[model samples]
Target: MHSFFVWYRVNRDEGDADMVIRGMMARLACRSGVGGRLIRKRDEPGLWMEIYADVADPARFEPLLRQAVDEFDVEMFIDGTRRTECFLAGDAIPAICA
Candidate 1:
């Protein structure tokens, strides 16, 4: 199995990361052929990221990726990366991706 991670940031408050974002994000994942997505909140400071994973082609996730920030505005800024060169080599997805 292969996977990728999408990293981004949002305020650590509710106003910016609202319910609409959650619903939309859930919907996007459903549409993308992904089983689901995992959302992580930083313990120390301002950071929000979602890791979308599955066996589907990454290209199919592009629309959801673009809509995440462009339309929903759930994040302040998104710094994304594809785990092509280096990736975790174990069963712990959260430990490696987060």
Candidate 2:
């Protein structure tokens, strides 16, 4: 499986952020092989992170990303910079044994 991470900051005072994110998560929950979680940083109030795990297939994933951007009006909520990173399980290293 591959993992996708998205980090961004939003203006919490704006009412749209929470609704958009919750709607996106609900949609993701119904899709097969796709799962994710939304997290907010405790230290950095507006900073948020989304982590997703599923089979690696850009063709399938890209559309979802685009849809979210369009439907959620993400441009309005997202702060200065938004970053996304994808990682493959094989690229990771386990802790070394003593």
* Candidate number achieving the greatest lDDT relative to the actual structure: 2
Clashing pairs in 1: none
Worst 10 residues of 1 by lDDT: 78-87
For 18-86, candidate 2 gives per-residue lDDT tens digits of: 778767766754553576788889998689888887757856886777676676667678878678888
Error of 2 at 34 (Å): 1.0
Q: Model 1, range 8-52, lDDT digits (tens) per residue?
A: 554456554546556656777667766545466658333444555
Task: Give each model's whole-structure lDDT.
Answer: 0.53, 0.75
* Candidate number of the best TM-score: 2
